[model samples]
Target: MRVSVDTDRCCSSGQCVAAVPEVFDQDEDEGLVLLLDAEPPVQRQASVRLAAGICPGRAITIHEE
Candidate 1:
């Protein structure tokens, strides 16, 4: 699985970070979505997908390979 977040469309919402802290985080200055890991542990895939779904800005995208 791969994860990607569009910074341009992101609104600094912390939902992704809250849902998948292992794969997502916030920039100290902007508080936007910061991808900590693209290929996270297998245990985190569901949470990452959940985060993408809950993102109001629709900035999160997940790909399964």
Candidate 2:
């Protein structure tokens, strides 16, 4: 799966980072959601989806390949 984040829409809740640190992170300077892995491994797909769903700002998006 491919993951994306919209910093413009991000509320910096850090929920995505908490759900899947392997695929998401919070920027140190702005505390915005960061896409650590645009394309994460299969083992991390489920958590990636979870992170997208739990994102308060709905900034996380997933495209399955």
Residue-level error in angstroms, candidate 1, position 51: 0.4
> What RMSD, rounded to one decimal, does every model reach?
0.7, 0.8
1-65, model 1: which lDDT tens digit per residue?
98888999999879998998888899999898899999888988889889999999999988889
lDDT of each: 0.90, 0.87
- Candidate 2 colliding pairs: none
CA lDDT, candidate 2, residue 2:
77
Off by over 4 Å in 1: none
- lDDT, candidate 1, equals 0.90
Cα lDDT of model 2 by residue, 1-65, tens digit: 77788999999999888888877888999999978889999898988888888888889888887
Error of model 2, residue 46, in angstroms: 0.4
Error of 2 at 64 (Å): 1.2
**True-vs-predicted CA distance for residue 64, candidate 1, Å:** 1.1
